[model samples]
Target chain A: MPRGQPPLSLPALIYEPKVRGIIFQVLLLAALVVAAWSLASNVAVNLQRQNIASGFGFLDRTAGFEISQQLIDFKPTDNYGRAFVVGLLNTLLVAGLGIVFATILGFTVGVARLSSNWIVSRLALAFVEVVRNMPPLLTLFLVYFAAIKTLPGPRQSIELPLSSFLNVRGLYMPKPQWLDGSSTIVVAFIAGIIASMLLARWARQRQVATGQQVPIFWPSLGLVLGLPLLAFMIAGQPVAFEYPALKGFNFSGGMVVQPEFIALLFGLTVYTAAFIAEIVRAGISGVPKGQKEAAAALGLSAGQSMRLVVLPQAMRIVIPPLTNQFLNLTKNSSLAVAIGYPDLVSVFAGTVLNNTNQAIECILITMGVYLVLSIVTSIGMNMFNARMALVER
Target chain B: MDAGIRNRRIAITTAALLAVAAGPAMAQTKTLDTVKARGTLNCGVNTGLAGFSMPDDKGQWTGLDVDLCRAVAAAVFKDATKVKYVPLTAKERFTALQSGEVDMLSRNTTWTMSRDTSAGLSFVGVNYFDGQGFMVKKSLGLKSAKELDGATICVQTGTTTELNVTDFFRANKLNYKPVVFEKLDETVAAYNSGRCDAFTSDHSQLYSERLKSPKPDDNVVLPDVISKEPLGPAVRQGDSGWGNVVRWAHFAMVNAEELGVTSKTVDEMQASANPEIRRLLGKEGDFGKGMGLDNDWAYQIVKQVGNYGEAFDRNVGAGSRLNIARGQNALWTKGGLQYGMPIR
Candidate 1:
């Protein structure tokens, strides 16, 4: 419209920013395709020259090597596919246990850092600072070498509070042995959970409609826990505990946790908890102090004010960072290789690759598993964060 | 509008040109020639395994395996110092060789069939004969390996020792659990702390561990050989010329010892009346030249590091702290397993 402006041509219309963006993206995509094609051809040529065969058919072959520690039933004669499962389960076991313990320790230390007692707060702060600075591998070595190795032998095991035993070999504890009718108890427990959920929903609706709240917590707890016990009693209480008994040279008739698993779990939990504590501390501090004061102004007790008002808001900020720590813990489980825990990376990536001489395929599968796990975790955490986010009209 | 169209065309053409140029660059190959032209041999050694490959207090490597690495360097450049020792562990060693990070691996590596064929590596020859054995504390009163039926064994994670221990226990119908560690030091430490009932590894390694332990005489290696471990040197499979250079380097040492050409008498042997001794000392013929090495390549190796027997006796045999008798590692003339091929 201006006088100095020249008329735009048809080609200029096609080359506008919006149009150019599409063209640029297409070009980038084409370049990527070409690069990939060339890389594939180069690999083909190299493989031919080196006489190296590349395929996933090796997964069907027998993995002749025996795993030192396996959760699932496995033998050297088992297929490579079975070995993969063994590795996956081992990884999940470590990550799952590490997550549970790290969260507990993290929350306690985080709150203690804000404690009224001077010594407690200082000690929590010192732990966080010291652990966060050291490498996870070093921490693992310290625990495995200095801490666990110092334990007494089987003959001189340290008796814990319970009938549990701790020795240099491993932790020996009483394991639950399920007899007949245990399935009935399990079924009843599931039914109890469903009943509790339905009851809670009904109580919420009733409270909203009549402005008269029902004491749902106690009733729900009773239904969920009491029903299971009632079912067990009616079914003749079929489950029993097998306490570990010391034999001549070793413990027998109970579950034994290997030192490798303990060291890995201990290392991961301590390392990840330091980061989680920082996240928790930051989350609590981020909540405006006015929220707590507001709850107090409403005549709420200190405990109720913090729990009902502060924690809800703090958790909203904490869940996202806490999720990140979870992902980190999962990845760090690969370090179990250092202690020879037979996790996915050590068993599948390291041992399997060595035996099969299929480094590319093995490493790809290992990385792919990790990538899928991370993606799933992130998606799950994002869904949780969305649910906790504040709604504004 | 025309200029805009022209610019777009130019951009597309440039990308296409780059894509075309990348094909040739990616397909290029000449790794073998590059190694030869470099003159200096890249040799992989074990990091700090005593009697195999360990750095001295003065930062120089000294051991039988380290000597093998130097021998290869001497064959290549007529100077034993022209070697760069890339210390590698068991897990990293094969990958390093296959990836061309090291020209040859002279570490105390077991020469297995799978590694020879599947790993794209060629074992030239066996340098030492080793076997897996158990080492336990003297106070345990475990005189024989068979005495401990349910003993927890501390073993290094990735080695033949792991498989051997399992087979031994399985065959004996004994129930034993292994407490595996990635590093030798950690495994030994675990064993010393009584975390494990016994430590299973190569007999040579057990000997080394005993020396490094807090109380050297407090532990003893059991008199049981669990597995056959033919430790040797290896090179990449594709290059026959490079493989010969490495293989002959080892053989030269063995031949020198068999001919009684010690480091002290190598110079005198060069002028000997015996034809075979003269030829071996690089005085009569160009035998070394045929193998792409200097005539005096073997002379340099012996002069710098001594023969194979000397290196063995000094590091791991009767003369060392290990006090291991050369039962199978002795020469053929001495009625032992080490019967090397003739140089000619």
Candidate 2:
């Protein structure tokens, strides 16, 4: 009877539909847990032997290091937590500014790549071709070492427009001196923004009711610009300018933007714009050609057709990937360590880790920061994407 | 029937847990054993620190810290050249040591309380007793560091010297801006390009870096010594046996210098009637053996790498281009800080 039994089939188990997935998933979960536990215990023993303290208590100690740029009041005597805030703010500042500039440049280049003029298209193609193929670190080095290194020294700072000077130290610009009673002008600027929003809403409604389009663009700009100017004049121009004049060793009266910060910003912008340009080009190309023809058939000009029909659809495809570029730009800002820009990774993870010798704690904190930043960015972008998504009539 | 299978599963899981728990002991070899098995000492050093530890024109590493690495190798391997030099930056030096990337770290790093207690490093002994100083152009007509008010200072990032400069400027009630670069060469380049009015570092570093300036004579190190920076060779904290070898290697150099044992006179001094010299030259006692080394380990170190004074003058002091004074780095018998323990 036993000799007549069939042979065991091993591969037959995976073919069982319900049992198959559970077995695979259970095996994966067990493997992950075992691997993680082993790693944790190994790290624990190694850390104990090495005498490296593990925990976040190091964050509470005085940083005892000077930070060059801070948005809030900070000194060398401040705690490490404050130092981290300064670094995080700097990272956010660079990321925000870099996103704005990169998007503008990317969209411009992406459109130029499809330009009717051959030279324009070729130049755009060459720019993307050269920049995208290069590594970000090399771009940073080139900007810092080659480009910024060529700037004149402090003694022979090259003067620029708008009372600015370029030197090896940094770019120095006139500081805006907010005099007494400048609050009223700021209040009026806020009022101007609110009034424009209301006016646009009313105009949209008026068009829906009467089919008469109000000229909104120039009027909105004039309102915002004129309201601020009128307020400034009414308050007797409460903002003075302190121009940078060559003093002892540097320009004394104005602000000195560090070459490191500028170089990093330049590197991030140049590198990220290349990727974004491709995204934009793909997004625009994804829009069907018939849509442009439809806009033209409706008696719109070439620019109007593009603005009214193609760009709206293109943006739907463009935004999701554009958010990815923004995140990449944010993460790539960590390369500031190579150039010494004091970004979050460079300052909080690097200098503080060096000072405190708490690698695990510092790294976890840095990882947590980047995780939160990326998550928040993704959330905001998803919300924006949802708003622009198609809706059934 | 189910209980039998459950027992087997539990036994397997327990064994796996035990293996991982024993990982620290099983996975790592002590630096001493690794170095012996590898036959070449990995010595982490500065990439190029002029007088402290920089390569010569022939690409051979030569400097004060390089000599310390050689001295340790000689003590262990009886051959000075049996060392693999690992060039590291200021930020990387401590991490390299902590992670066991090098057997001994012979960089121009200062021995600070935080580094000792927090970074899991044990400094063997002070090899260079330096103080922070500044170098400013003579054309500025600045005679003293105190007069450097509102001066922009260029410094290497991730150095205690940077913090020292900050402390000094703040203590003196001076308003100074610090421009930091990631490497020493970059810092010097920035200074040379006149990005900053003055460059600050350990006094020895100032003298060495000034040589890189287009007009070395134009920049003068200020008379002020702002902070005490005792540079030394360091080893990881977990292995005292290895630490003892490194510590004694440094001490043997100083004791030889004090006992009048130069590299040339070492062999002859083994035959001397002087008790101290005899013990030092390994003519008496098993001092090196106590430290898990050969009886003639000190002799090997002296014969190969020279004593402290010879290393000092040849690499950084009067004999070299830096022309640094042996001010506080001299033997304690000559009224300096370096004093070796009695060999007995």
Candidate 3:
């Protein structure tokens, strides 16, 4: 109401929406910082009074315990830091293997559920219903307790095809033993793959330009396969097989996949596959029927219609949901602890916490590892999803 | 504009009122007085470990550790019924004590140096002498623990038992793979399922677990004792008054046992002519006053829960299913490690 040229310029500036928002946000941030500082100081005071050391220095100490399952060489005399890495690698191995098997089983069941036969469709539906209804922990127990433990011991090992033995101890199979000059053979095999890919690209361009078909498939396959075999022969067959044999009391001389790993993988795959099957079904159903009809109108067969016209579009919808199931499978691998599998949480967090009495440190480290793994997985999947997304012209 | 300022003033006044309403109870300083006024004592116990702490078919807890808690309540209130038992697990026990969920912990917890210092807890006294040992299936023909080299041992997590097993194996230069489970029941099940070659824990727990097994005679515990495990009661640190009360309550039971006292004949002992008996049974002096209890406190405790030896024999002693001898848990006068302070 003042008639002066300037009527409270700063106050008017402060009343602007942007300025007010900035001020409010600053006040909130300051309040949170102060609150966090107070909590930190309170905890520090309590810890000081209790005379408990709070730092990461304890990581250098010897672990003084053995891990039941390890991917890398480890000993009780190793430091806690190394033990954490071993546990992390074990977790990743289970998660990776689980993802592969779950995807295979899930896609199969998803396709079977859409089959023309009533019995096949119903069987697929029943599998998804039964598995997804049960808790993952219960499934883990069922696999470990009922399925794996019911197997006979090494002396009565069930002989399978290809010189594999299934028993309570483990699945004993022949492992590939790399002899001398195997590295040169591997390099030649990789070189052969690159050459075949280049040759296929050249063949595709030639066919496009000259209107003449080139039989590139069989030649590329022979280049990839025959070259590797030729390299192996040139190197005097530098790969040997070590078959598992029943010793006095146990199987020896082969790679033994422990029952713990099998049960955990079986549980994770079954549980995740059920959820993934639903996602796949939803994605396939999302593809319009018109696309299939149009493909058939173009003189394409049913299988060709699905593979060429529908599946690519359906995968665009399927991949995003499928990534979520993958993440869940990764996190659910922590349930391996229930059956005494030495996953990250089991070997590093639980056992290490008990041995060192460093609950806060061990739990924080374990959770940090999981968080990093989740973030990396999500980022990678998002990148993949972006690549698979339809590009509009 | 002036009315808006008045509204702001009123809002500020209400905000101050809410802050005061949401403040903490501020009753911590009156804890001692409140406990004294309340007749009963709330004691925390282990849920079920047959001889140490377990409820019978009638839902009444009757074990050596449970009796120790009842003894403390009887000492405080002169009535055994004044005790309330709160069951706790290994993970929840210390937190329950720190948060004042129970007056004391009478579970069979080991009194370790780190727990005494870093866990914000205080051990009252060692009530039972125990050790970590291994048990194996008799079919394995494992005559000694040393025979179990490179064996997979099932152990429960979150307890000192795991650390002891590791240390024992390391010191003996033997290799082992540990299959750790969060719960003792799961570990025992894993061992019974042959997922593990051996099971390791406190020797007393091995005995209790063997009894609960479907075929108790099929498994045999090795004779080698690996580590000393002093099981006792505990209370929160910074409350020496409560700590002393619990400590002396355990001492009273052991001292009464040493002086030929039993729950059945405590009244007769109180009437006896012996000076030590008169002092212990609260017939002569004000010994219980120092512990914040009545003059007849020791008399009530001994009368309600019996002596230490009687409590032990009834639960895990020579006559029980465990059939454990009074080796180190016997009185110091009988050349064992148990030595209690004189009641005088």
Candidate 4:
């Protein structure tokens, strides 16, 4: 109540919300810079005290370690940089395969769980309950130790139906050796594909214009299959089957899928599919019963209702979570280390880090790869989710 | 009012962060001080390498490397049991040592040029002299290492043995595939599953691993020692004073063996009239004090942990599961390469 000549105008300006927020932000930025600087200096001082050269210069050094299951042509004499590429490719390969297989298996199991049959739904329910309760790493251990270890030894490899042998070493199948004229067959098959696509377009237009159907499906199928056979006969059957024969203590002259790769793929797919199945079931159930009834009242068949009506809407609810499953499967591929699959973490971070003693660089690179992979997966998922989003009026 | 409190908080945090990093800039390093302050030495050993460092059912550690750790503990605290064991795999051993996760790494690590020069580590000295060799089934009808060309071999990953095997095959112009695993148990399982034709490791390790096979008698270890693997103890690259402590601790045991001292007789030898024996038992010289240890450091080490000869016999030599001969690990006087320096 004792009024001064100046009514505290400067304090009001200093204590403004906008100015306070700016000050807070600047202080935060300064704090972050200080923290980062101190951490970097700590690392530098430790490296100096230990006389360790810190940089990517060690990547040029000859990596004397051998990675067993490399996707690239990695040799013991290759540099450390090549080792990282090999590891990254292997990680991508397993993640890619795992996502494909898991989507198929998960959708199937989800449909089965939604079935009216008691036995089918119960079986699917049991599978999801058991697997969803267990850890992914434990599932990997079981697939590797219990399942893969029980396969027959190389000498007693089980004869599969398609010239493939199942054994403890791997699944060895016949390799197709292309003699001359194989390219002509492949070109003919591609021509058949183009012809089928054109026929589908023509049939659609004709049906729209004239009140008649062209019956294009059977003809397209015939062209796709028959053209390849016609080309093969014309080429005098240039493909020779080089079946895997037992030579010495192992199989020779064939394509072999190592047990480590199989175990990793199986474990990742099966474990991820359990959770994906639940997501899929929730999406399918989220479609109201009234929607299907409405389609039936419109004189649509059951299959037509599901394919043209229910699934499209259900997928709207399914896609965002499904994208999450895909990312989870990709990140979980790093668990291939447990089975010695030579994935990124195993080959690059585990072995290379130990051999070169460049832990910080190796770890940063590994984390960077995973971060980029995750971001790319999320971006792809976001694109799909946007496409499936509800349309605004 | 708010700015005053926030500024004070910021000052405290900055001070704390700077203080966290100010230790290394001091004139003298403090690895020994840290170990003493912690009261228990963190010793990294193999996860379960039988002769080197394996735990029994009672969780008591006993092996060559384990004994060395106890000797260091005895030398420091005069209490041999004052030690903590960190079980590390081949892939984790170097990092664990370099990061100071363990004060010393007494794992059976092979000393190599790359490991010493670039890996920020220093090999104390050779504790067990070993050589890389091959093991195969008797059913193969292969007699020599050279005859087993184009063979798939099982090897532990992140090891010098893998590089050695690759060099062996390349130098001989042979083709082969290597099946590598992270764990020794997994490597053995893959080999036993008929996934590989041969398993290769140090000769001492081959004997121990072969015993774990289903039919041990059906396998035969090849006689060729392809590479000289001087397996020894390693410490971090810095702290020369601590490195010297670990190195001389092992040397003291070897020297005691050369001086004909044992754990049972070390107390009696302390009353000897001989100058060399008196100096070694810390009666005449203050060498232990120069290393920042008590004058009776060697006495405690020998009295509690025994000499190097006893450790070798009970762990990997003739009295143990390995039953390896003292080819290069015997003392210098016994025509072996285990040369010891003068304790004085």
| Per-prediction tally of clashes | 0, 0, 0, 0
lDDT of 1 at A235: 93
Question: Model 4 over residues B105-152: C-alpha lDDT tens digits?
Answer: 998889998888877788989998889999998898887889876677
TM-score of each: 0.91, 0.90, 0.88, 0.91
Pitting candidate 3 against candidate 4, the one with the higher lDDT is 4
Best by lDDT: 4
What fraction of correct interface contacts does each candidate retain? 0.29, 0.38, 0.31, 0.43
C-alpha RMSD in Å of predicted model 1 compared with the true structure: 7.5
lDDT of 3 by residue, B1-344 (tens): 12343244234333322322232332133334445577667788876788988889999988889988888888877788777887765644654565456778998899999788766678989999999999898888888888877677888766788778888888888777787776676788878877677899899999999999889999999999988999999986766777788888899899889988999999888789988889988888899887778888889988999899998899999868778889999999998988889877
Question: TM-score of each model's B chain?
Answer: 0.89, 0.91, 0.90, 0.91
lDDT of 1 at B306: 81
Q: Give the better candidate number (2 or 4) by lDDT.
A: 4
- Evaluating just chain A, the predictions reach TM-scores of 0.90, 0.89, 0.91, 0.88
- The DockQ scores of all candidates, in the order shown, are 0.23, 0.25, 0.22, 0.31
Interface RMSD for every prediction, one decimal?
11.6, 11.4, 12.1, 9.6
- Residue A361, candidate 1: how far off, in angstroms? 1.6
Q: lDDT-based ranking, best first?
A: 4, 2, 3, 1
**Candidate 2 lDDT, tens digit per residue, B180-298?**
66667767876776767899999988988888778998999899999999999999887888988888898999999988899999988888999898788778888878876788999
- lDDT per residue for candidate 3 within A91-119, as digits (tens), equals 99999999999999998898788989999
For residue A132, give model 1's deviation from the true position in Å: 1.1
Off by over 4 Å in 1: A1-14, A210-221, B1-36
lDDT, residue A258, model 4: 84
Candidate 1 B-chain TM-score: 0.89
